[model samples]
Target: MVAPTTPGTTPTPTNDAPVADAAARLNRLADGYLVTAALHVAAELGVADVLDRGACDAERLAAEVGARPGPLSRVLRLLVAEGVLVEFPDGTFSLTPSGRLLRSDVPGSLRGVVRARGGVYATAAPALAEAVREGGVAFERARGEPFFEHLAQHPAELAAFQASMVDRSARAAADVLAVYDFGRFRRLVDVGGGFGVLLSAILTATSGVSGVLFDRAEVVASARVPEGTEVVAGDFFAGVPAGGDAYLLSWILHDWDDADARRILTRCREAMGPDGTLLVVDAMLPERAADGPAVIRLDVTMLLLATGCERTGREFGELFASAGFTLRRIVPTASPLGLVVLEAVPA
Candidate 1:
């Protein structure tokens, strides 16, 4: 296979592998990225909404978006073949089931995700190798600044990132809740919970469960506090909200390394009542290190864009114990987001 020669590098067609394999990999990378860009543009143009009502040919759809049909047709054809759209014999196309994810109207949809990815995350993807060697996101190298700092400077991009996370939390939270039992806790705190979707889902599913959402000051400044939920502004690395019977960190730990994760966990441990529980909602890889590439690959993805890594259940057991939280149970969630509930007391 052709390897990227440098960070922020694209592997060009080369003589390393057999002609066909090299060509295929390079083509897949280049074409796939182009397709990613297409999805971004389609989501931005509200093409899914246009197609949601009915099918329209490229010319009409392009006209709706005030773009030329010739260029737009190429994108439509590529997406149709990719099952994002269904093409009719007459050349008009309609949205597919996957296309629903591109609509911003639906809860848990990927509209914001695709937009943010195509907008900002894509810029960081190519620099993945540098990030791997450097132990943090190559955002600085890629964009000349820290990720959150860049977000702070660009309000619109920050909004897009938060919206993307909020939408994505819905897509994964239901399956997550399905896999974990919320029967043990009365009140919970969501550290870095964007829009409190996961906490709301947990509370909505379990009776008499109230929750608190702690996030950045600006991020939570305008967040609507849903019924039975309180929203607060705080830093996770510094500390978190207090007085909850249980604490929850959903996909938050994966944004930081072991040290930062330990600090955050220590904060929660300090804040928890003697009987309080801590539920870490994350993707816990398998106990044995041999059977999976998905977990490790995603860890690599995190390394490329953030300073984090996915840990195995055994790793969690070790990490939890170190942070003064006991590993009580590792519950498997329905989706990739696994649930590992730890407690303040020893197991």
Candidate 2:
């Protein structure tokens, strides 16, 4: 009902629609954890893989995946609502296009990421409030151990983490190679390169570029590097391999704070010649929060999990200057991860 206004007086208009819409948005946001949990359950049960073979009823799916029929059906319905799955008229379930990403054998499989987020990352969620109140890592407070140490102790979680990294790096590599010219360098060293995914891609794409894959001793032990790649097992904090015209630190710096990142950059500086080039592939945080919501979310994840943080272009420049390097140029990539190649040269 609208109240009548006197002459020459403005009447107040009433519209509850915007308020209702805002409330609905907030409600959806608040319930996001439920979707995450459901996705985790489905991923762990290999529901998408099973459905890829063919659609099946909840009871059959439950029998195959060792889940209770009722709960599985509820989860399937939730996924259908979320557009990750589709429900047939015959009460069977099938994977939607988005749901196919959960399959373990797929090109961009997110099963590992799902396992990690739903398992270890979820474990640290409760400590986020405490971490905000007290300046410390949420994972360390929640699990009573550092992030990497926890991964070391838990092999399955470690494998999942590695798999996620591989999936992410594999996708980013194509985008990087498409934009950057690694063929200019004679020798390329990939420091802290896990499993040599990026190195493999570079070697495959560029001719006359010999690669050196360097990482921890344990990491390089099982590394499946390309043929002719020189595998070196050592700690980057102590030192990195020398003699390469270009050194690549792909998706590495974001796992450390400024001081630690500087230490790493210093090591690379020490190992490389004055003419050597350093290429750091990482997510460049946008200056404005609204412009880079995904990166901001990753920064929050870093706060929850480790001492690392995503950095802006200016921050990377400062870090480079502090480590005796001059910021050469930033090459933009078409990666969905918002990755950029920050090219630097020794001061």
Q: Each candidate: what lDDT?
A: 0.78, 0.90
Q: Per-candidate TM vs. native? A: 0.86, 0.93
Please give, for residues 1-347, the per-residue lDDT of candidate 2 as tens digits: 33578999875446776567779999999998899899999988999999999999999999999999998999899999999999999999999888999998678788877878887888899999999998999999999999887877887777777777777777888899999989899999999998898999999999999999998766677688889999999888899998999999998899899999999999999999989999999999988898878788888889999999999999999999999999999998876567899999998
Best by lDDT: 2
User: Which pairs clash in model 1?
Assistant: none
Q: Which stretches of candidate 2 lie over 4 Å from their true place?
A: 1-16
Candidate 1 per-residue lDDT, tens place, 90-155, comes to 999898899978877686588888888888777888777776686557766798787777887888
lDDT of candidate 2 at residue 272, scale 0 to 100: 93
